[model samples]
Target: MTRLAYSALSSYSRVQIMRLVQDHPGRTITDLCDETGLHANTVREHVQRLIEGGYLVAETERRTTRGRPRVLYSAATGEAAASSPIARRKAEEAARRGDLMRRVLPWTADAELPSDALHQIDALVEDLGDAGFDPIIDEGALTVDLSPCPHASADGSHRDVLCAVHQGLMEGVLTQAGGPLRIAQITTSCDPSTCVVMLRR
Candidate 1:
């Protein structure tokens, strides 16, 4: 993760917004304000920060008639190349980090694991590390075990939100990494000691 993205997600409010948008795309600022109980200006600021960090994408809402179209925000799923210069730079940095991490990390010498899978794993591991997941990868099972989740202290609804945001983050990273690998499921336990993320082609 780039510094900007790290900073953007550091705010709990922003993570909530990300989780909301990821769950329901094309949400307007007013919608976010109502759901989050944040002032419209505050919601707009958070949304803009998410956009600048490349965690969210913004679009002009389509309208048949009437006043100006509302601006909608949704999680960035890496469907398209980075649109802004800041986002582009962050992406380049992430790619560089992924390459460097792959080089320093141990790998299965046997050709059992394809290069594409390795690339995807590298990206996922890098992002998880940045987010303080301390991931342990099992190449054989194609699963990642995340221990001591940073937000493990959160309970109930907050826990659900954290899990959703984390899952979305992984999905975005995997998509951007550009490989056949994808997240099949993420099993999060009430006991924050460990959360297993299963991946598949």
Candidate 2:
């Protein structure tokens, strides 16, 4: 039997979700919530982080419903998700890749921000936290370190898309807050544990 260690590796909910998915590939988020007795939103957040970390895969489930499709998840490299648009469709540009990740990414049309630096920083932190980035803002340094990045990849190859989405999200929020700080460069780690964003005045 294989011995497993989980502490310091993942959050409690995330560990539970991954184990469940491994045991039951293609389990829907709702199914997982019921099994773990956790809230649906909590499960979804852990699942999203796992997916972003490349530890799990998410595919859409089809039903005759009018709203967003249900997502089925499994350990990474598991069987292709049944009816998954990403699994079925050809690879394309980041903007054109219509998937749940796109919808979750914190981005919208650009706007404006205030000249006051401190207020802008506070508002940006709130926005990022609401978006699940676990953000820590350093106004003196003009940088933010996001842990358990909801979009970073274990491999560096996908950083382009992941980093771009983060950049856009921050841009939108900062502009809306009336600070209009520009993104100087995004330093994504190959570790996939966190990513840092440096802002330009």
Candidate 3:
């Protein structure tokens, strides 16, 4: 049995079509067009791509009362299943992290504060630092540059910890000084040592 090459799959539409076929195997082009709200031509195009990419298999099924045989489409079940394990694992991990965030955010968002927002920023950096992250606060932005590159060093589990900590810090600050707080942007680079965060009020 040949395995599906996930890297060969690109484009949101193609991915969506594959997922639909996987869920409802042995469906027709008309069925997919109705389900996805895409035109028949568009569905055909994606299906052809999937078939060529080896992610799907096509067959003909004959009905007893039908005038002619109908062509049916279905995911290459064994190949699709094999290729999907990593993606499924990642999704499960993400869900778990989301649950953890839900629990942590409320506490962070409700904390009382004394004075000096800059001091609060310092405290957040200190906390992150103590937790093995090297945090730097400068010019209205706090950047936590992790030494070990969490993605490379730790399993996917650390994502929750990192997310919760950042959420806690943001909530703690915004709750105290309640007015427009902007989380400019958060990014991770291919190099684990380089993560940048931009923030503004």
Candidate 4:
């Protein structure tokens, strides 16, 4: 993942915008402004940042008889987002960084795992680390434990959107990593202290 992508999530307002787009794809800027009560300029800036970060996709609405179609936004997904040249290049760079960290760090136990699985975990860890999840991997159980999750502060009503977006990001990472491992599920909690992400081969 790129630093830009991680930084995009650092703002709570941006996170809310992301969740809104994820829940309701093809939302126009006006719709986001209406829902978020943010100024139109602020929403436009946030959306532009999200688009640059590869977290959101923008498309023009199609209309038969209209002066102009509105611009719509939606959350980027694993397959579609990773297909972009820039996104693929970033993923490849992240994979290289993950490999470097694995080699230099104290993750000696990772040696026992298959090469592909290790690569997947390396990518996952790097991405999660960038997002400040403080991920702990359970190799035997094929799960990643996230403690003091950055996204845990979201209100209960938006919890589902938070988790789903996170899960989608993980899937995107794995897909970009070109590994055999995948995110099977993410179990979120009412408490912000912990979340579990299950992996499957």
Model number with the top TM-score: 1
Give the residue spans of candidate 2 off by over 4 A. Answer: 1-115, 153-159
lDDT of 3 at 127: 33
Q: How close is candidate 4 to the true structure, as a TM-score?
A: 0.77
Number of the candidate with higher lDDT, 2 or 3:
2
Q: Which residue pairs overlap in candidate 2's backbone?
A: 112-175, 113-178, 113-179, 114-178, 114-179
lDDT of 4 at 97: 70
In the range 1-201, model 3's lDDT, one tens digit per residue, is: 332333324444565666666667778989988888999998898887666544567778868895887778866533333232322332233334434553687443223322234333433343344334555545324443444543345445644344443443343333332234445666776655566556555
| Residues 1-201 of candidate 1: C-alpha lDDT, one tens digit per residue | 235554677778998999898889888998999999999999989988888777788888789999998888878887773233444445456566656765787453325767656777776776677676689888888889987677777666777777888798788877776778889998877587668999998
Best by lDDT: 1
Candidate 4 lDDT by residue in tens digits, 1-201: 236666777777788898887777889989999999999999999988877776777777788896898888877654663243444566677667767776788555465667667767876786687787788899888999997777667787776666767787778667766767888887766676688989988
**What's the CA error at residue 7 for candidate 1, in Å?**
3.2
lDDT of candidate 4 at residue 176, scale 0 to 100: 62
Per-residue lDDT over 39-82 for candidate 2, one digit per residue giving the tens place of the 0 to 100 score: 98888787776555444567677879688887778664312332
Between 2 and 4, whose lDDT is larger? 4
Each prediction's total of clashing residue pairs, residues at least 3 apart in sequence or on different chains, is 0, 5, 0, 0
- Better-scoring candidate (lDDT), 1 or 2: 1
Which whole-number lDDT from 0 to 100 does residue 58 have in model 1?
82
Candidate 3, number of clashes: 0
